[model samples]
Target: MEYILAKYNYWIYILLMMIGLYAMIAKNNLVKKVIGMSIFQTAIIVFYVSIGAKRGASIPIIAHGHGHDVIATAVSAAEYANPLPHVLMLTAIVVSVGTLGVALAVCLAIYRRYNSLEEDEILEQLR
Candidate 1:
């Protein structure tokens, strides 16, 4: 119970991932699938960003010193957490949005061509 409560973010991420996967696999609507993909990507991004966080730690910036031994004392990694994962997640978010836009545009094109946005209906029309 303690572990579950302590790691609640993991549970939330897992739940979101499952919901997205279910929508992508079971939902018949193309738009819904795209939305699911976006949700999944968001969950992954959130997981990465959250995991990168350090408790009681400061940012990655090194503390400036007035003495000559600034590099030795100020660069200790024990007090600061790396911010790369969070930065990478920001890039991932941009890419995900662009991908979602392209996916929705493709769904729109398919709807324009078939006059329907449903997977089953499109397959039936193709048959």
Candidate 2:
């Protein structure tokens, strides 16, 4: 029970990822596939952000006082949340947005060319 409480967020994210994977694999419509891809991307982003979270931690900022001669104190790593994952996730989010835009544009072109968004229909038109 304690383990479950501690790791529930991971489990939820995994469930979301599975749902997205299933939709991408089993759905008939191109739009549904795109939606599933977006969901998968979102799950990844959330997972990364959650990984960076620290209990009883503060933001990664330094506080300054009005004394230049004051002795510098060592900062503990555990007192601050990890910023690397957050930064990487920001970049990932931008890339995911661009990818989704390109995918939707391609879907639009496919729909215009074949007059259908279903994979079977598109394949039939190709053949």
Candidate 3:
């Protein structure tokens, strides 16, 4: 029970990721697949951000205009939340948005050409 309580967030994220994966794999509609991809990207971003979280930690930024002696003694690595994961996630978010846009555009083109969003219909049209 204690283990489950402590790691509930991880379990939730895993469940979300699995849902996205299922949607991507099992859905027949192009739009639904695109939405699933977006959900998968979101789950990845959330998981990364969650990995960076620290209990009793402050932001990574340092205050300016404070005395050098005070600053030197007051700041420590343990006191600040990990910033690398956050920064990487920001980049991932931008890339995800761009990818989503491209994916939607492709789906739009597919819809325009075939007049259907269903995978089976598109394959039939292709044949």
C-alpha lDDT of residue 70 in model 3: 65
**Top of the candidates by lDDT:** 2
The order of the candidates by TM-score, greatest first, is 3, 2, 1
| Better by TM-score, candidate 3 or 1 | 3
Better of 1 and 2 by TM-score: 2
Question: Which candidate model has the greater TM-score, 2 or 3?
Answer: 3
Error of 3 at 105 (Å): 1.1
How many residue pairs clash (N, CA or C atoms closer than 3 angstroms) in each of the candidate models, in the order given?
A: 0, 0, 0
The sequence of per-residue lDDT tens digits that candidate 3 reaches over residues 1-127 is 9999998778888988999999999999998999999998888888988899999888877656266566555557787899999999999999998999999999999989999999999999889
| True-structure lDDT of candidate 3 | 0.89
Identify the runs in model 1 with alpha carbons over 4 angstroms from their true place.
59-78
lDDT (10s digit) by residue, model 1, range 52-113: 87877887666675667665653656677768897898899889889988998999899999
RMSD, every candidate, angstroms: 2.9, 2.5, 2.1
The candidate that achieves the highest TM-score relative to the unseen native structure:
3
How do all models score by TM-score?
Answer: 0.83, 0.86, 0.88
